[model samples]
Target: MKDFSDFFRNPHVWDREIVAVGGDLSSERLLYAYKNGIFPWSDQPILWYCLDPRGIFDLSKLHISKRVKRKINQKRYTITIDRAFEQVMRCCSHRPDEETWITELFIKGYTEFHKLGYAHSIEVWDEDGKLGGGVYGVAIGNFFAGESMFSFTPDFGKIGLFHLFEILKKDQFTLFDTQQLNIVTLGLGAYQISKKEYLRRLESAVGTGKKWTPPRVVF
Candidate 1:
């Protein structure tokens, strides 16, 4: 594998809030990007972004709604980590909200990342043993950079995230990098920090050398 250091633009210079707009999504390249707080979003020409005012989850402050709490306690879904990574990504791309950036090429690239133990997924299965919802992202050190999430049933995505954080907390992970903020994430307790501060945290988080481990089964 060749080094991709030369392919990346300086993330510090986000004249238009875009880190880089064109590059092949190779395993090496994607890994490099994540390590430096850069990620590719679904867009024409495949834009890479490191957004200012980055949205991140502070596990200690996560807000679990009464309904979500009920759903979790009821065992409406079974949570499994890293069991259906590719399936999770596929489902995320097919989400109905908007067109997705998870193209076939992106899938192939991240699949390689999974093989090398750098990417992971959190899967939510209904009682019928079907995939109801899930989330997928790349993991480096203690940082889990969320790529996307989707739900087939209401709040299934939240259920997946709730359990995922449990595992992350138990494993002593530090940062759950959510990239950009939205209503769903905001309601779930995500807060924003300046990109400068984010980069500082990312530097420390990516150096923890914490290996991603599969979560204990949620029955």
Candidate 2:
């Protein structure tokens, strides 16, 4: 990892790696980064990015196991959209081990985006009507820029993800952006690709002239 100091002072550009600048970031800055194919990751203030190849899950290319399918069919939770987006963001921020930059400003900014019909959320509620798992992010046309997720129980992530997948599949979404690579998501079939390729797909999807029409209620 490069020092946060030199990064912002002089942004570096490499063939395989993308540019990374260092500095403070607000929610507005974060959204601007996403739209520009850059994101922030630092305890201090550094912007790091992997240029080559982006990670994505094409709706037509998703690989859901039969067991997971059965479990999803079980229908143990009530899935809702955007009704509790802020709650979903809080839940994702609550997970331990990582220092989250999801500040109060982020919550307010994303909430405003939700009101404008760009951001979305999938919330899973158990039989008792308590929140179990959730996922939230920005959706530009048919492409979903998934930010974070949280689960109160094992496999709740699967439930929340599958629920979102079902809707995207039906709606013919072009891509699902998981942002970065991790064992958990890799196991779920998310893989990495170059930023150029990611940008291409992103442009195509976002430029398709489709409007985001969130479900009246959770699907």
Measured against the true structure, the TM-scores of the candidates, in listed sequence, are 0.92, 0.79
For model 1, the stretches where C-alpha displacement exceeds 4 angstroms are 1-3, 13-15, 208-210
Q: Over the stretch 121-155, how does candidate 1's per-residue lDDT look in tens digits? A: 98999989999999898888888888888999888
Residue-level error in angstroms, candidate 1, position 90: 1.2
Candidate 2 per-residue lDDT over residues 65-125, each given as its tens digit = 7886786788877888877888988888895887786766566767786776678888888
Best of the candidates, TM-score? 1
lDDT of 1 at 81: 80
Backbone clash numbers for all candidates listed? 1, 9
| Index of the highest-lDDT prediction | 1
